[model samples]
Target: MTVTHALEGDVLRRQDPELADLLLGERERQASTLQLIAAENFTSPAVLAALGSPLANKYAEGYPGARHHGGCEIADVAERLAVERAKALFGAEHANVQAHSGSSAVLAAYAALLRPGDTVLALGLPYGGHLTHGSPANFSGRWFDFVGYGVDAESGLIDHDQVRTLARTRRPKAIVCGSIAYPRHIDYAFFREVADEVGAYLIADAAHPIGLVAGGAAPSPVPYADVVCATTHKVLRGPRGGMILCGAELAERVDRAVFPFTQGGAQMHTIAAKAVAFGEAATEAFAVYTHQVVANARALAAALAAEGLVVTTGGTDTHLITADPAPLGVDGRTARGRLAAAGLVMDCCALPHADLRGLRLGTAAVTTQGMREAEMIRIAAFIGQALRDEASAPRVREQVRDLAGAFPP
Candidate 1:
């Protein structure tokens, strides 16, 4: 059934009309707007069914056949299915499908491998690293000594020379390769080599690209990193959760880290949903979908550049794009506000070497809704128009409404 029809027929609608109205409003908002947010997407109705299933009430607090609670036979089966599917999907020797979110997955990776005060290396926050990578206010930064590497100032790419120099000079205990805003594919092999050189564990936080990896649209870090952390959402098109992948050697450590170390009980429903998503991702149709996601992103990046935005790395190689809207007469923050007003939703992100923030857009959600490269070009145009003139917002909004209505998410 369509999302609108499902919501209308939901038991919540009859039991709690007020709350149901809010849920419907949210559904309407998603269907009516352009979901350019890099971290959001539309999970299939089947995945949604699993998330809203009776498993949500289960309180199984341990691994399969070893739960801390009773009546966990079904929960055990679901979690095991999720674990096996995840391992097969990513080609990892072992998988932990229980971390609550990407940050939690990262935390578990750190917990499994590093000790307090051990030096860790990751991309600097200013260079698109995630907070878990080592923001001073985050636990990663607070508990461990985190050295940061940066991207090249001119090319907007990772500064490999600088990374090597830092690794040799600091000899960190762990090296993390991932980012929240970087649009290029990470060189996991290079990181593995460096980690080996410094006797550091290579932790690949593949949260953003893991979905693309599942669809064979991006490179997988599972073969190189000592531990891989990823979110089930994003391009994976699953529930909002995290999972860890590792070789069999570290499987027991990883499991303990996720359970007693970082998180407690698994969300059986989300795990089941993750399994559904993994199964869907392994299909040939999903492979085509992921390739289209990248194609749409490339088209949008090119279009945004044509409109005078300074596209990061010249363009994108994946489902995400980062660009500065300064040439459009506003900073990233203002550009985001203008875009939102015009029914174009996205995020403001730090530009690698620049002082101003830039816009980060993704094609995963729109592509799921059957939007194509042509739609991306139109979106870039609307973004340019909206950024250039706030007074044109109403007209742009109407146009966006027409475009979005043509492809309901």
Candidate 2:
């Protein structure tokens, strides 16, 4: 079903005009404003249809054929399709698509491999590591002994030497390599080597780059990481959910950890939507889209750097980009507010080695909306204009609205 059918249907509007109006307002906002958030993307209408399908009413509690709920025969088929498609897309020996979100996938990975109190090594939060990697507020940090590695202060890149030193000294039970705000490609092989040296399991929290990996725009972590956790959205352009990939030997352990240990009652509708996304990602057109996403990101990063934002790691190798906007006479938080007022929506992130925050944006959603490098260049200029002159907010908002209309997301 199309978005129009889902949102503009008479049933919802007749039953609750209030909720219908709210949904329509969100739809209008999405179409009118630019979505630059690093973790967001636009899924296909096919994926949306699956999400709103009858499968949503089902309550399958366990894996495929062994589900606890009755009348799940069709749910089993949908889930099996998602699993097989995921396996084929990533060339994984085993795929588990049940986890509710990327954090859930990480929790299950931890459940499958390491016990509570086991020492873990990961990139520090200041260096763009995700909360699941080792945030004090997260379960991973509280349950496990987490040692953090940092990035180079001047270069704004991962300190490989520091990671090795920490791994050898701490001798963690597992080592995770991934980041949310980092722009460069991670060296999965190097991380695998470190894990081998320390006799620790390697978990690649590839929530950000898995989409690029699917389209061959980035290196795959499947071959190196003992357990790979990723979100189906972002550049993947799927419904929002999490998945895990591992070898056949660990499949049962991963499944058990995801279902019985961490979560229950799988969402069959989302599983089916993931299957549609996996199918789309396997196409050559999707590969071209992924490549363009990188190109758009690089162009935008360069343009932003030209505007005096300190482009972290020099530029981006993936869809995501994080840059300190302090050179523009405003901090990241202030810049975010100004940009939002000017119709540019994004997020504020912690800058590596700096006390203040930075602006984090991505091209995934805009790219899915059919924007190219030229639009990215204009977007950077608009951002610059919005930041440089407070009185120009109205004009910048109009320009942003026009640009967003041209893309028609």
Local error of candidate 2 at 211, Å?
Answer: 0.6
Q: Give the clash count for model 2.
A: 0
**Mind sharing the TM-score for model 1?**
0.99
**What would the per-residue lDDT of candidate 2 be over residues 1-409, giving only the tens digit for each residue?**
1376778989999999899999988888888899999899888999998999999999999988898989998899999999999999999999999999999999999999999999999999988988888788999888999999999988888999999999999999999999999899999999999999999999999999999999999999999999999999999999999999999999999999998999999999999999999999999999999999999999999999998898999998999999989988999999999999999999999999889999999999999999999999999999999999978889999999999989886
Candidate 1 per-residue lDDT, tens place, 102-213, comes to 9999999999999999999999999999999888899998999999999998999999999999999999999999999999999999999998998999999999999899
Name the lDDT of candidate 2: 0.94
The residue ranges of model 1 lying beyond 4 angstroms of the native Cα positions read none
Cα distance off (Å), candidate 1, residue 169: 0.5
Q: Worst lDDT window (10 residues) for model 1?
A: 1-10
Evaluate residue 379 in candidate 1 and report its C-alpha lDDT on the 0 to 100 scale. 93
